[model samples]
Target: MTTATLPARSDLGRPIILLMAVACGVIVANLYYAQTLIDVIGPQIGMSASVAGLITTLTQLGYGLGLFLIVPVADLFENRRIVLGSILVTVIGCLAIAASQGPTSFLVASILTGVGATGAQVLVPLASHLAAPEKQGRVVGTVMSGLLFGIMLARPVANFLAGSFGWRSTFLVSAAAMALIGIALLLACPQRRPRGGMRYGEALASTFAQLRQHRVVRMRAFYQSLMFAAFNLFWTAAPLALIRQFHLGHAGVGAFALAGAGGALVAPVAGWLADRRLTRPTSLAGLAGLSVGFLLADWTVAAGSLIGFTIMAVLIDAAVQLSQITGQKLIFSIDPDARGRINAAYMTVMFVVGALGSVIGSATYEAGGWSASAIAGAAIGGVATLGFLLFDRGASAPR
Candidate 1:
């Protein structure tokens, strides 16, 4: 369990960072690989299409639970241990899902996979811990770009793999990946015992305490929550719109999703800007960009321009990453000693609120169409903009 102690310079300059980044991407991908496969995985496992949504829902819910419970443990334990242990759990979950022949078993495996995938969150704060203050934003940004890649690639990759092999093949591949990533991390990661003296109960209690104690945490969570809501909304509804309006099949939707991956290219740039202390203006631009992207998509969808919609997808995704990177850099700097707990609070609330976007996106698209979903997403962005302008900078802002 003991890792070799390396000097900070070589450690930070070395391959551990890349390992963590790739580890994060692969681990988080476990949460999503089954999302697109659920439709096919369902009937074989005796789950009806109507009830199949729970597969994705339970995974997300399990992720939420991990964000609330497991991520905070990073502050109190050796992070490498937490990271490796999480990988082990996810590998188990993936194997279980691959082998499951019943709906109950598959759903349980999905939840376990979701929970274990939160190792990505721990690795995120660990990136900051590993980097010097001046380099924290850059390091976090690089790693986050990997996380974004996982999110962007999971659906399309799942579809292609499931098509070629089978739905179970995706989970089997994920299990094998975790086994490899876990070994790499086990070898490469350094031992960083956290400085926390808090007990388990106090550490858990402090997650909420940190949110109430820090204005930056509250506002950052608020802004990111809205941005994430807009993100999930556009993504959830856009594919349905493509199918309903343009007659594009799953492959076309996958390609459209792939096109949005280009947006993750901004994550590093945003982080660099944050390192320059440009968070305020960068955040303003992100909010405005999101609103504009949604509006453009609205017009494009009405005009039946698939290319225009794709362009908006890239823009919307870029704006979301910009906002995310900016907020994350700021908040990670907020509480050095409690990065894990604060991050848990930040992400937990953000995702809880963000999940509503999917709900709203589905409802709006089914009820009123893509325009309504876009408008609703735009409204969420506009609200975040107003909050940033009106409240976030209200006299005592850190940035």
Candidate 2:
């Protein structure tokens, strides 16, 4: 696919950006609605905690597969159609999930839902594609902040909706929200058609080739994998800790999750730094923050310090966003024409591992309660920090 820059005022206005952000938040929100609702969804559907991890794992697996299988198609086809079509699939998946009475159907729907959620990923590149070269980071970051809000708010919003109505209501609402969001995106966003020089088969093949050819793609993928893994671990386990350890009801969990969404606020700042060539230092800070955040959570969870737990939880959340924004900015700059494919390779690796995090989060908590989960999260974060520090050479950042 070839690249062309679009004007800021005509194509990339604040309204368009806002719509993109909202669309991204609502679309990606599908992946996370169940993270906090596992407690509620599992018991009603007859799934054990051991098996509950499959909920996130399957969803993430579907998303990873979509990143590799579907996202790169944007390089060959019209961007808007692919995005809207994915949203349609997401709506179907959400409705199926809402209607499911057993684990088999629900799990199947989870995969479908995850596949559909890649609309948000597609939008990330589309937003990047439309912006002028110098402002791509800021534009991408703004869109990403929407994604982060969806991730952060999905838990609380799902909890609140589920608390008032039922667990199924969350998905029902998500399906509806997506329908509206899809239409808004269709109407508001300018259509960008990639020059159709590459075939689907070649685009898919080149996506994999990006990982082998680009060190930045590989290293950034590895880095975000750790951040995402630890991120999934903490958020997945946190609701259980809140309910069992802190004795908070669904409302309380929703409130805490709402507060935690504050962590996503760092995304714009991360993007800004990335634009200014501060990605290297910001990357280090994010990883170190994750390690420290996990340790602090370890202490706070044991002591039943809600204030402390929230602080550390937000820290972990912010650190993950920090790393992600920087990593994405770096990777996107590797090849402007190949942003779609590079992003697919990077996210596929990161999210597949990240999916495992949910499994570990629930299983570890079940096995050893909050302590084991928190420590494991800390260890993962530390390893990421150390690996980056010891192994990363100075020239990895894009020149």
Candidate 3:
């Protein structure tokens, strides 16, 4: 069970970064397809609205578990094999969903899909590991643009598919895309397994211990967790408010989805900034934007203002995407050799926090109404923003 060691320099080129992004994008998109289609899924499966939220909850949980459990395998196995194997499993999960006849089956499929989709987390490390140290941010950012694009596009794509062929067929379409994407990755990506291997126990021990002891990892993990909590809170409640309060159709929600897509366009720029020694400012700015966005969301929710709410949503999406890239840049800077495990740990914590926020937001929205929920979300996000400002300022002073 020794871990294989890749060469000091991998044969990864710029084209590979682009290809990896596309492949990972398709894979990551699987986890969010349900987000847009829950309206269809809940009724079709006879689940309560509250319970239907579990689709996202369970998927996030599965993803977090996979990040902690499966992603660390990159330290032991070849990147191509790991990526291919995970894609194959993901395909199976997608088929399970397409064929499912009830909520229970689809729920199981969703969890499995999340586990398989963890390959994107592993790919993040592989791309960073392949690039030159000076170019890590740009490479990571390029790949993340694909990831964020997938995330932003998943909703609109799902809306289209659900509108056209019905919900189950959406799963089938994603399955087909996953298959083609997997083959492309198998064909294009270089093999990166090292000649010598470390024992599995040793590798796992090293990673787990690193997570426990690394100050930077701890700080980044907390930073990502808090930011993602805000992200989850907003997404979990926004659609319900749009549909129930405003009476907008799925298409309108899909259109609104584009704002986030537009905001995510900053991912590569954030990555470029991180590489150029602007990590602190980049992170702080993202957090500030998020805090302001949440406050705006709160104001609109209270005032029942549509235009203001939409603007707030766009700002929130942009800010969250920026924070995500900044966090990744910071994490990748730590212990470059353990990029896979580190990223896995980072994403696992973030998703777990997000899942928790989703649960809290949904409950608060249902019980106290959207205004209360908005206030709750803003308060949590406000604290995280303040923490980031303090951290950024500390980094500026002379030792």
Candidate 4:
């Protein structure tokens, strides 16, 4: 898909961007709605603490697989059709989860939910494809703000809904909301078909080829993997810490998670920075902030300061979002034709590592408590920070 053959670069006005952002948020929320309900859902379903972590791990694992399997097809299919189909699958998964009678059924539905949630991934590259070259960063950032907000707010919203109704009811409600969003998207979003005549198998193969071909793709993936690991580590374990160490109930957990939603505000700023060609500095600051956030989380827990803990959560989330947007801005600029595959490779690595992080977080929290989880997060963040400082200086941003 050369520039000449590309779809007309239509204006991405505020309404379209807002619709895309909200749609992305609703779709991506499926992956995280289970996180805040782990404690409640685990016991009701007869899962052990260690095994309960799989609730999140499986969702992320399935999403990672979809990134490699489904997302690449965006380069070969009509974008709106793929997105609408994925939403229908998500509705089935959500309904299945609501009706599940045991852990086995619940886990299977969770995987499907994750796979279907790749619709959000589809929209992102679609948004990039629609925007003009000069405005891609801002457009991506705006859409990402919605995605990040969904992630940040899903926990609180799930916690609140589960508290009011039941854990199962949350899934049922999500299914209904997704159906509505699907209808809106179908009517509003324009059809975008890639110009290339590549087969599905070749499209998938070229994703790997891009990985082998681009140093920036590999480095950005590596860096983002570490940052995302720390991100998952903190979120997967923090609720447990709040419940166990801080002696908070579901309401308190929901409130704490709500405070962290403030971090999503950083998405636009990160995008603006990227638009100005400040990705390198933004990346470094993001890494450092992640490292400091973890350390501060440890201190807050020790001091028994709920306010401090909330602030730390905001800092950590901001850092992760900032790094992610910067990485995305870099990758998306590399090959317009391969944005789907590039994102697939980048997110596949990031989430695979993130799945591991969730497991480690659950294990460490069970064994050594909040301090262990915090230290583990800090260590991962430190590695990302060091890697960026030492290696990223030689890398050049795409013009």
Q: Please give each candidate's TM-score.
A: 0.96, 0.91, 0.88, 0.92
lDDT by residue for model 4 (1-399), tens:
422233467656778888999999999999989976888899898888989988887887778778889998887778889999999989999999899878899999999999999989989988888888777878888899899888878888887789889899899999999999999888878778776678889999998788899888888888889988888789878989899889998788878888888888888799888888888888888988998999999999999998999999999989988888888888888887788888888888887776677778888899889999999999998898888778876453644
Task: Looking at model 1, report the run of 10 residues with the lowest lDDT sum.
Answer: 1-10
Model 4 residue 276 CA deviation in Å: 0.5
Best of the two (2, 3) by TM-score: 2
TM-score of decoy 4: 0.92
**Number of the predicted model whose TM-score against the real structure is largest:** 1
lDDT of 3 by residue, 264-317 (tens): 667778778878878777777777777778777877867888788888887777
**Shift of residue 371 alpha carbon in model 4, Å:** 3.1
In TM-score terms, candidate 1 sits at 0.96
Q: Which candidate model has the greater TM-score, 1 or 2?
A: 1
> Backbone clashes in each candidate structure, one number apiece?
0, 0, 6, 0
What order do you get sorting by TM-score, best first?
A: 1, 4, 2, 3
lDDT of each: 0.88, 0.86, 0.77, 0.86
Number of the top-ranking candidate, with lDDT as the measure = 1
Candidate 2 clash pair list: none
Name the runs in model 2 displaced over 4 angstroms.
Answer: 1-11, 35-56, 100-105, 366-368, 395-398
Model 1 steric clash pairs:
none
Provide the global lDDT of candidate 1 against the true structure: 0.88
